[model samples]
Target: MRRFERIHDIVEPVEGYRRGGYHPVHLHDIYNQRYEIIGKLSHGQFSTVWLAYDRLLQQHVALKTLKADASKNNKELSTLRHLSATNPDHPGKRHVLELLDYFEHDGPNGTHLCLVLPVMVSDGEGMTVNGKSHEATYVRSISKQILLGLDFLHTLSIVHCDLQPANIMVSTEAAAHSETFLQPPEFNPARWLKGMTADESAPNYLIATQRRRGQLDSADWSELSVKIGDLGGGGREGNHRKSVAPTALRVPELIHQNKTWNASIDAWALGCLICELATNEPLFPLGIFGLSAEQIDHEHLSLIGGLLDGDGQINETFVKHLTDRLPPDFGAENIQHLASFLGLMLQQDPLKRMSTVELLKHPFLVGDIEG
Candidate 1:
C-alpha cells in the first residue's frame, strides 16, 4: 500500500522492470501457489534469486527466476533437468548442486522460468577463514570436492563452461544452524513508483532488503562441504562454446581459439582457483589500471605463455614462480607437490590437462601432501 519516490539502492536495476526483463516479485508472493518468497538472495544479469519456502516439501530453497527473454531459450534449465534425471546414485552427484524443481510464471512482463535449488551457505570463496586465504589442508579439501563435482558432470558428457570461485558454493548442513532460516525478516511491501498509477510492467512493490542465510567462518571445516553451481553457461561436451570463462580465468585453448574447447576448461579454472586459494590473489591479475578488455585478454595470454616452455610444458621457472606466490606456511614439500599437481591441470594444451578422475587420485588430493 505504501509507495516510494525512487528505487532503492539494494534492489536490482529499475530499468530491468521492462517487458522482457526481470519479473517483479514481492516478498510473500507465491509462485504456482506453492513456493512462498521469503527474502532476496541475489541477482544476476539475467535472473534474480530469492529465498523461498516450499509448501509441498516444507523446506527452504533458492528460487531462481530468469528474465522473460532469458526464459525463451534457457539452456541452464534444460541442463538442470538433464542432470536431475540422470545418475541419481553417483557419489560425485552429491558434490554437485541438485535441481529440486522448475516451472513457469506468467507475470506482467512475460512468462519467467523459476528453478528451485538447495540453499547453500555461500559461494566457494566462503571457504576462506574470516575473509582471508584458507589453510593448505582446507584448500585441498575444497579442491577435491570441486574435482568430484566436475567428475560428475564430465562423466555425463557435460561441460561447465563457466567454472569459477563464484560458481562453486558451500553446502548447508542441518546441524550447522543459522538465523537465516529461522528468522525470515518481514519487509514493508514496496510501493508503486511515485506519481505512477499501478504499472502492469512492474511489481507493486520491490523488496529492497538482501540477506545471506548462513555463516561459514564458524563452521567446522572437517564437516563442511562445497558444491559446483551455476550451470547457465554449461553444455554437453564438445559443444564449442566461444570463451565463456572470465578473462583472467580463461585457459590458453580458449584464449587462442585454435581448437574446440570442452570440459577441460573447468580443469584449467580449477588450477587457477587453487593458486588463488593458496595465496588469496588471482594467478592472472589482468585488466588492472586502465587496461581495456582487449588488453586484458592479451595480457592473460602473455602470462600463460610466460608460464610454459617452447614444448608447451610448465617451465621450471614457473614452478618457482608458483612457489613464491604460495604462502610460506605451506611448507617447502607441500608447496612442491601442489605446484606439481597444478602443473597437470594448468597445461597450455587442453589435451594435456588432467581429467577429474586422474586429479582425484593425485598425491596432493590423495593426502600425500601433509597439512
Candidate 2:
C-alpha cells in the first residue's frame, strides 16, 4: 500500500490507486522498453489512456491500459485483433479504428492489458463551432463516414453497443507530423512529489492537465476523416447484454432489456447522431440535474414515442418538431428527405430498422439531397 502527504489534484480519482485499480503510470515511464509515456489523454471507469511514443516505430500512439480487474474478463483485445485481420478490401474498413499492438503489463496493482492505437485529434463534439452545429454538407459527410464504419463492424457481426458522440473520433493531418504531435507540457516530477512519501504502487507524478487538440471546425472537412472508436462495450450480434449505450441514446430494445438486441442498436444510435450533427441539441435530453433513473427512462421513452406512430412510421408531429430544430436555410425538400431517412433507422422494432446497406443507399447519404 502507498500513501501520499496530501492528495494531489490529479485528473483521475485518487481512490483509483488502490489494489486492482489504475496502474501508477508516470511521465517518461517505459512500457515493455518500447513505448515511452508522454502524457495522459483520458480516463474512464475501467481504464486510463496515455499518449506514448513507440521507440521501434518512432511514432506516437494512444496507449490504453485497462484496470487489473477489468483486464481479466476483457474481450476488447481479441475483438480488435479479429477486426484488424479480416476484410482488408472493404471500403468501410478505413473508417474503423485499427488496433496496432497489444500486450500485458504487470504493475504494482496487478496485471493490466495495454492496447496500442493511432492517435486521434478530436471527437464528434469537436465538429461543432462554438456550440453551434456544422454546415449541412459537413454534417452529411461525417454521417456518411460513421455509417460506413458501422457497416464494416456490422458486416463482421460485431455490435458497437456504445456509439455516442464521444466515441466517434476524428483524425487530422497535423497528427502525422512528429514535431507537431510530440508537444508535451512542462512537468517536474521532483517538484510535484517533493513532500510525498510514496511506494512503488503510487505514480511518481500525476498529470493534472489533459492533452488538447484543434477543433474539427477549424480543419478542412474535405481532407479530415472520422473513425468509430471505443469498442469496450461491443459484443457479437446475438449476445445478451445487461446494459448498452448511453441513456440518452438508448433504443427501445436496450431500454426494455431485450436480450437479443443486435446491430440494429447501432443504427438507432446513428440516427440520434445525425440529428445531433444537424442540430446542436440532442434528440432526447435525459441528463437533467435532478432526475432519477426511472424518471429519466420514462422521459426518454416518451420522447421516442412522440416521434413514431403505432405503425412505427414517422409521425407528422415529429416531422414538424425536427423541421423546427433544423437550420432555417434548409429547404422543404431537404427536410422531408432527412425526416424520411431518419424514420428508416429510428424505429421501435429492431427488426424494422434499416440495415447499414439500406442506410448507405438512401438519397440522404448518396449526395442526391443537398443538405
Candidate 3:
C-alpha cells in the first residue's frame, strides 16, 4: 500500500463523502509515478474521477479515486482485473473498458484506490455515448456492441448489476491506437474548430457544444464506439440474491424482490437503455417524491401491467401475454417488432426473460430500422 501525509492535515474535508477528505489535486499533480491530473471529471457516491495525462504511456486517461473501503474497492479491483485478463488486447474489444493500472494512495481517511482507465467522451448525461441525437441506425449499432460485451461477461458468469447509460462510454479511436490516443499536440481540443463541424441545428449537438468537455471533432454518432464501465455494482452471477439495479432501471424480478438471479437482469436494463436511445427518453420516468422500494415496484408494475395478460403475471408462455402498449403512432409493424422483444426482456419472471445471447438475434435488433 502507498502512504502519503494525511490530506486532512493540510485541507478541510470536501462537502461530499465521495471525496473522503482528500486534498484537492491541481492541474499538474502527478501520482503513481506517471499520471498528471488535468481536470476534475466527476464525483460519485464513493469516488471521484479526474482526467489525467499519462507520462509513461504518453496518453490521456481517466483516474478514478475511490474511498478505500476494503470490500467495495476490492470488488471493483478484482472485477477490473478479471476483465483485463479476459481481454488483454483492449482495442479489439471496443465494447469494454480497459483498466490500464491500479494503485493505492494514502489520505487522512484511509488508503484510496485509484483506477487508471481510458478517458472517454461525455455523452449528454454520464450514461449516453454522444451528446447529439442518434438515428435508429446508430442506436442499433451501439446496442449490438453493448450486447457483445455483455455476452463476454455473462459467459464468465459475471453480472454487471448496474448497466445503465452512465456506466457506458464512447471512444473516438479503435482499440488498436489506444496507447497514443489523445497524446499531446494530437489531442489539442482547440483544433476541433479546424477539424470537424457538428450540425448546429440539432439539439443534442447544441448541448454537446455547451458542455465542451470530452468533445471531439471526429466523433460521429453513426460510427460511435462504446464500452461498458463502472464495475463497482458488478459481481459474479448468483452472488447477490437481491436486486441491485437502480430504481428507474430496476427489472420486474428485482422489483418483485426475487431471491435468485443471474446475468439476465442486465438484459432487462439493456431493454430500457435501447428504448431510451431510440426515443431519446426514458421509458419509465422516475417519480420525484422519493418512493419506498415497494412503492417504486408498485408503480413499475402498473406501467408494465398494461403490456401483459389476464393476471399480469409472468410465466413460461408470457410472450403470449404481450399487448399493444406501444404508442399509437409508432406504426403497427414497429409496435409488434418492439413488443416481441421487450416482452421477452421485461418478463416478470427471470426464467421467462430471454438470455442476452438470444436477445441479440431478436427482430428489434436484427430487422431494418423503422424510423
Candidate 1 C-alpha lDDT tens digits along 144-233: 888888899999999888877778878558632332533454444445556866676766656543544335656666777788888888
* Model 1 misplaced stretches (Cα beyond 4 Å): 1-11, 125-130, 175-198, 204-214, 288-293, 308-328
**Candidate 2 pairs with clashing backbones:** none
Model 3 TM-score on a 0 to 1 scale? 0.74
Candidate with more favorable, higher lDDT: 2 or 3: 2
lDDT of each: 0.76, 0.78, 0.62
Between prediction 1 and prediction 3, which has the larger lDDT? 1
Encode model 3's per-residue lDDT on 70-178: one tens digit a residue: 4243688897787777754433355778788988876545567889988776542433334344444565677788888888778778888987777777666553234
Judge candidate 1 at residue 22 and give its lDDT.
Answer: 89
Model 3: per-residue Cα lDDT at residue 161: 90
Backbone clashes for every candidate come to 1, 0, 3
Candidate 2 to truth, TM: 0.88
In order of appearance, the predictions have TM-scores of: 0.86, 0.88, 0.74
**Residue 112: error of model 1 in Å?**
0.6
User: What CA RMSD would you report for each candidate?
Assistant: 3.8, 3.4, 11.0
- Report the C-alpha lDDT of model 2 over 1-371, residue by residue, as the tens digit: 22444455556665577679889888788998899987777777788888889999999898999889989968888888889999999988889889999889998899999999988776775454346535556666788899999999999999998898878888776764343533465442423345565567656555653545444556766777789988888998888774458788888876776667778888999999888877777888776569887778788888888777657666788789777877776766777778888888888888899999999998877755554
lDDT of 2 at 252: 88
